[model samples]
Target: MKRHAVPAGAMLAFFLTLTGWPQCASAATPDGAALSALWGLPFAGVLLSIAVFPLIAPAFWHHHFGKVAAAWALAFLVPFAFFFGANVAFGTLVHALLEEYVPFIVLLTALYTVAGGICVRGNLQGTPRLNTGILALGTLIASIMGTTGAAMLLIRPLLRANGNRQHVVHVVVFFIFLVANAGGSLSPLGDPPLFLGFLQGVSFFWTTVHLALPMLFVCVVLLGGFYALDSYYFYRREEARSRFVESTPDSASFGIDGTVNFVLLAAVIALVLMSGLWKPGVEFDVFGTHVALQNVVRDVALIAVTLLSLVLTPRAARAGNDFNWAPIEEVAKLFAGIFVTIAPVIVILRAGEGGAFAGIVHLVNTPSGEPHDAMYFWATGLLSSFLDNAPTYLVFFNLAGGEAQKLMTTGATTLAAISAGAVFMGANSYIGNAPNFMVKAIAESRGVRMPSFFAYLGWSSAVLLPLFVVTGWLFF
Candidate 1:
């Protein structure tokens, strides 16, 4: 793609191009109403999802079009606005200046293609009481496969594995916690926020060591708690399974066809890191002019990886394995819907409570005057469950890194809250994280209906919320 210029005049003009411009005037975003302006795109996306998905999906989904649409719209609309905006030279380049990490992540995770790479299925004749085991397995996949891939690949089986229960909503809620968001905390490949850190001078190793502990702690608690719920539900479903004792779980297995794809994904990570670690603040101008080299390189890498993956991954393997473009298609369509619908509200927020809305970020205070590293670990996480975790994480991540103070908070604590919050609480609602929608889709295709968006959040408030608070207290 050719490069474009961001004239000095366009900076102000760009702000004016936005629909609502006053809400975030006093915010710490440093971008005036820029981020506030883009909020409308995702809101538009929500409306589009409702209008379209119902018209297209088969009769099987008639009962759930409403819940599914709400969830899908939330998933796509949030990220869509960011990614769609990033494609612009001015938008991405300017955004990078905030911390220089977010655009790095946006370019690297392209996320579109990663949605198809991982999955798991249960063997026939197996008792689904093994659901707890599967959830643990899904957690590992979240780090390795990326949440989109892991969720798309494993969600069906998880629903089926837990098929016999009545109170399965709690099970799905914990799945969102451990499988969708918390499990994805360790690697940039795991969740978008951490991926931003990777693109910023943050080390992958540091993330695993520092960030992994808190996420693991939360996952463990949820797994333990969910397993109890799963057990109770299993009692309800025993009769159902007994009636179908001949029930053979459709068998499922895992393999990448070649280890090359994993290696390539690693290469993408390396290239993204190199821009941050070695090149530090370079953006590719493409033309003779000097712009940030990393921006160009990151986007180029994303496009290249996406195309090459499509070409090299063998079409037959994808088809024979039941891999299809439908999932990604759904993301694109639903996100488009979100982008259009949410455009207005984003402007309103920018014009309204935009400034004070930043109360979300707070550095932890410890008596020793050292960083309370676990703060982001818990805070970003807790809010991520309720708020749009991506921006919520960013709001806090940005806040945490304020000028060094004599106070107990420090950079370490700031980073912790950013990482923890971004990854942990994103599981709080079906709308909390992206993979949540995919899991819902996969489950619906399998005839297992997920809870409504608000209903799922209710489950989160009841189960995962208390569990997260405890984990947050213990760890952060």
Candidate 2:
């Protein structure tokens, strides 16, 4: 489906937001302890479909991925409603749509829209030094303007710089590593999980204070590794490099278009901060879900900011950037299905020892009843690899005691471990974070020939897993 066409999952979400489909007046949240492991199969199916379909049936997947996602969503909802009652099913759907999916897509759309409007006017040759510099600059700004914002703003320019190169996959992969995931470790604005922490009363700068060393360690190692790898490829493909060097002028002046979007970018950041800092103790009920007022305002204003950017940005700027809504549309549709099916899994994890995944949950606590920092790191990291990292972070956060004051003080290391795991390991898969897939799409659109799902897993397993082990041992 095209960007203008709302997929089945998105249509359902929009319908629910405008007019809820409540089967009853009131309904309680699902009791995770009472649910079986079988309830999680649909969620697993959706993830597997994401991983396998494009590899096995590229044409069909490209044309009908949204229908596939909606099918898996119905697989879960149909059975749940048949067994659990319509009211419960409706309540769960409403909660997922209102509380999580809508807000998630809204913020991403705002970031994508605002950043896509800002175009870098000149392209530099993507040498090892230049690529490394762009990656480093992205990493630095990611914590400031958000990983999505930084990634969107820079990916086009980065791709344009390397358009003549034969060996470009590693460049984009390292971009995902630095800009999309690891670089977002230091601040709430950097990633969704950290933002959730801020909403839960974890101090704004707690991650900045606690995670700076670990972030530095990981970024430095990855940047060095990327430089070495890029140098190898650059020398191997020297012919392509020579052709590009001959064609391009050394005096091609660099400038930025759509500079107004930078101010809009700040507005995006301010809206997010305002949502966390300005709490009016007011909420509106949608079906059984209570939507907070500040969040509502934030979301509304974000949509306004998105529209404003579209109006103010020059047509030439977007055209130069090759901007389109496809990446954001794919994320919106796929994640709608993910949030729906992931509900039971989140509830089960929240049930702690009483739930289906009790063994996994128990690993984070020692026999002495204290939290295990390393276990928290790995468990949170591994789960965040597949589940939405924001909610996964919350699960571990609450497991270690949800109090922000306690987690920031006595359990500081534990909190840091959870934060790091949730932020860093999101690079493990295209589905791990929103920007990973968006970056892949944009690179593929530019003919980068990115890796498939399993191949990408191989990359992360080899490179990121070992580094994470070292990080766990050294920091946790």
lDDT against the true structure, per candidate, is 0.55, 0.85
lDDT tens digits by residue: candidate 2, 1-476: 11121122344445654665445336577788999989989888877787778889989988888998899899998999889877688879888888877887788898889999999866488889999999999999999888998999999989888877778899999999999999998888898789778766887778889999999999999999999999988886565445556223456578898999999999988898788778777766655677777888999999999999999999988998899988888878888898799888778877877899778766999877789999999999998887757767877887787789999999999999999999999899887888998899989998888998888989999989999999999999
Q: Return the top candidate by TM-score.
A: 2
- RMSD of every candidate to native, in Å, equals 8.4, 6.0
* lDDT of residue 214 for candidate 2: 98
- lDDT (Cα) of model 1: 0.55
Compute the lDDT of residue 225 as modeled in candidate 2. Answer: 98
- TM-score of candidate 2 against the unseen true structure: 0.90
Per-residue C-alpha lDDT of model 1 across residues 343-424, encoded as one tens digit per residue: 3333333332243333332234355434455665666666556444554554454444432231113466457666776777
The residue pairs found clashing in candidate 2 are none
lDDT, model 2, position 244: 53
Clashes of 1: 41
- lDDT, model 2: 0.85
